[model samples]
Target: MIKLFLPLCILFLMSGCKKSELEAVNSSPTVSADKAVEVAAYEVEAPTPPKEISQKLLPDVNQSAQPPITPKKIDTIAKKIIKNGNMKIQVGDIKKAQTQVGDILKKNNAYIQSEQFQNTDVDDNLDLVIRVPHKNFDALVNSFSDGVGSVLSKNISSDDVTEEYTDVSIKLANKKIYLEKYRDMLRSASTTKDMIEIQETIRELEDEIDLAEGRLRLIDDRVNYSTLNLSLYKEKVRSSATSKIGFGSRFADSVTQGWNSFMSFLLGIISLWPFLLIIPILIFLWRKWKSGRTKP
Candidate 1:
């Protein structure tokens, strides 16, 4: 009986120990502290970094090992677009030739940007500047050459603008990016002067950039298509008075003019009959002849 009692006491002790451990687990909110520590370590492993610092750090190591890039010979960008063309026509009348030219322009869907008509002792000329769509430019030029009797002088110019255009584009892109930053700063700025300054700078840069881009586009268009310049002259036609008259034509005109002059003189004398009374003796004689050379 004593041995059995002792064994039961040991079992009771073990059971009590197990129950206390279970109670401790139930009471504690942070269970499995090792797993929690592992999760927390994972969470704290990474942190967000500033953009500039990140970029500096992440640049390729190989690129850093290489030498700096060297620039090659840069081409000149044109200040203005290259536009050149010309046309010459020989015709009996410059005015009549211009009408035909107008018709041709309409047919080709082109327009005359400017024109000047001139005539001197030598000949007649029409100087014109016409603009046609890029697609139809060549066709219109060909037609102009075909229509004209001769081509006087042809000149062309080219503007190489690759470098200037590229530089401006790069500068424009950088300016735009900087301007965005300025805008962000503006939103948070407290001072009116600072805001106005930023706005003015952005406006000026935008205008300059727009002008540069426009000039570049124009230059590109001109270089892509060549232009032809021309001068036009027409031989003068003169008709003499003798040439206008055919056989006996001069004689008939003279006779007609003389007859007209004689009739005009007779009408003038009749119209002065009332005023002739002032001329005493002559008027009296005229009155006698008018009244009596008929009466007696």
Candidate 2:
């Protein structure tokens, strides 16, 4: 009986130890679950950083805030000048002068743009419009002045177009850039209305570009070639007989005066005919009166 009692006591102690271990294990899981719930609540209540929130909301703002692209710098340009001249010359012989002018033009690599000739009773005139290289303009003018004929009038004019050219060039370059950008936009366009607007803008830019290019071309042409207006004059010599009245003219004048005098005398005799009839009647009346008095 003592041995059985000792074993029962040992068993009871062992069972009690097992129950305590089980309770510890179950309580630990509940504590862990409660801590996890508290952590999740804290996470839900926290606010995001301001910078990170802005970045997420405005994704393209950084790109939009970037500065615009600048245009390319142009190199230093040369000066542009347009020159024109006007001259009038008198020569002894127009044909000879014209030949000399042709030779001079050949030497100077010049060409006549237009020519006009006029012949009047007293003088002959030749007008020429000449286009020559800028380098040879002065030489040609001197040659015509000294060798071709005597100068009556001379005028030379110069216009500076450097500023104008530079300004136009810059504007044209900018327009081209805008045109390319618009074309790209048109290609990527999604809406019909946007595409139509971009196309209209592109068309207008193209027209402006063309006009600017045309102006540049015209300016270049004037700068490259100089214009010269030349006039040649020749006076005709009159003969002595034509200049002065000759003996034949004087003889014809005398014959005309004699004929005029004879006609005047005949007209005077015809005017006296009416008075002649009245004179005869008065004479007859006077004779009758004198005879009556002598009879009384």
Candidate 3:
């Protein structure tokens, strides 16, 4: 019993020592300073940044008074915020106003998602539909309204899509987890049938993930830009503002049109004069002889 106890105790101590050694050697896989050189490009093979670049790129890296950021850690976080809003604008001189809006959009470096412009003859009106990128949309629109000669009507609308966006994001994350689990299952599947089932489940998860991603993209695009449905018109100059033409002017126009028609009719008669001449001359001679016989 003593002999077995001695061997077992030694074995346990050896196993414990081995476990500690493994743990000490196998550290967690945080991105190292070397791997952060090209961090913006998302590469993992970067080396330690130079003192100058590190100071320039990451000023707070060595700050203990402030929140400390290690040289090896990710430098700064990137965040994207999305919101959807729209506007309705009524302005005078639609064409000129649209041109101004275009200039504003360009100045703001906004992407034109879509545009539609229509001119109406039924009434003196033009309709314009414009979608500008989300980032500078509100500011750009504000600047635009300032230049509008007179805003006959204006309206603004908004949709709070934050909750929906967050929902899809979380759902997509879970689907990725599920997809990874299914992928693992596929790799370790025993039977062919089991492998096929796992793959099928993975496919479903991928489809769901894709759908969620598409929705997210749509939300991102819509939120980034504001849509403006603008209606504007160039007012017609009414006849009351102008004096009527004098008698001389009226007579001249009448004479011009009448002379044109008369010339046209004379040319038509001359063209058929040969045929008319023969018929008229023959009738005249017959009447002359009849008159001469009656005189005798």
- Candidate with top lDDT is 2
lDDT (10s digit) by residue, model 3, range 196-239: 88988888998999999999898877776666665555554446
Candidate 1: give the clashing pairs.
77-161, 85-228, 85-229, 86-229, 86-230, 88-232, 292-295
lDDT of 2 by residue, 1-296 (tens): 99999999999999999999999998999999999999999999888779868666875878589687899986987999999999999999999999999999999999999999999989999999999998999999999888887899999999999999999999999999999999999999999999999999999999999999999999998889999999999989998867898899989999999999999999998899989789999999999999999994
What C-alpha lDDT do the candidate models reach, one value each? 0.72, 0.94, 0.72
lDDT score, candidate 2, position 151:
93
Q: Model 1 residue 66 lDDT?
A: 64
Model 3, residue 278: C-alpha shift (Å): 55
Q: Name the weakest run of 10 consecutive residues (lDDT summed) in model 2.
A: 54-63
Write candidate 1's Cα lDDT for 1-296 as tens digits: 99999999999999999999999987674666767888899889968689777757775985578698899976554454344565565666666667777787788777776777788866877787776654566677777667745655555444556666677777877877887887788798788999899888878877876886787677676655445433467876566864476868878989999999999999999999887766897877888889975774
Which is better, 2 or 3, measured by TM-score? 2
What RMSD value applies to candidate 1? 19.2
Off by over 4 Å in 3: 1-92, 133-135, 237-296
Candidate 1, position 11, lDDT: 100
Worst 10 residues of 1 by lDDT: 223-232
Largest TM-score belongs to which candidate? 2
